[model samples]
Target: MQVVIGKAITYEQQRLIKIVQKQLSEIDKQHLKELYEVTRIKHEPKDFSINEVKREIECGKDIQSLFQLANTILPQLKISNESIKYYASLVGYYSVYKLK
Candidate 1:
């Protein structure tokens, strides 16, 4: 995940970025690290990202559904309900940054 903080940031976008940074800071990083270490399969999954979904949500696009988004991102691993929900939650967290 490479992030480039460009010189063209708006005040509103910067504010939202701060909010996301704060929300991210409150999360238990170690737990997520452990979870990823345990649950990841050997296969290289699809290439979509939460940022992509956040871009869609920010654009006011009809995202249709989280399950659909999950399938788009994690293709082969949608064998269980929990996996989809988990990925959905992570993706949904970025919804806070959507333009309101």
Candidate 2:
């Protein structure tokens, strides 16, 4: 499904964006990278089961580590890239991270 991230962002939304981007960038797992790239290229949200996210984190990297990487990358998407919240919100919810 398509997510609308181009909606004007508020300051609180900016914080949320920063957190997710930071988390995404800190992730070190190959699978997480693969999943992220897939989502990016598709321009769609990823549909990963919690178990899958857990497995990718447990087997390759810690979930929080991946989240931290996300936090770093998310905000950059707005300025230097396309709005990834559409794709990222899927990852955030999949990873069970609360976005404010």
What are the lDDT scores of the predictions, listed in order?
0.41, 0.49
Query: Candidate 2 residues 54-85, lDDT tens each?
Result: 65555444345555665665555554344464
TM-scores for every candidate against the unseen true structure = 0.22, 0.28
Per-residue lDDT, model 2, residue 95, is 38
Q: Residue by residue across 17-62, what tens digits does model 1's lDDT show?
A: 5553444332333333333222222223445698666654543333
RMSD of each: 17.2, 11.9
Q: Residue 3 of model 2: what lDDT?
A: 30
In model 1, where do residues sit more than 4 Å from their true spots?
1-61, 65-78, 95-100
- State the TM-score for model 1: 0.22
Top-TM-score structure, candidate number: 2
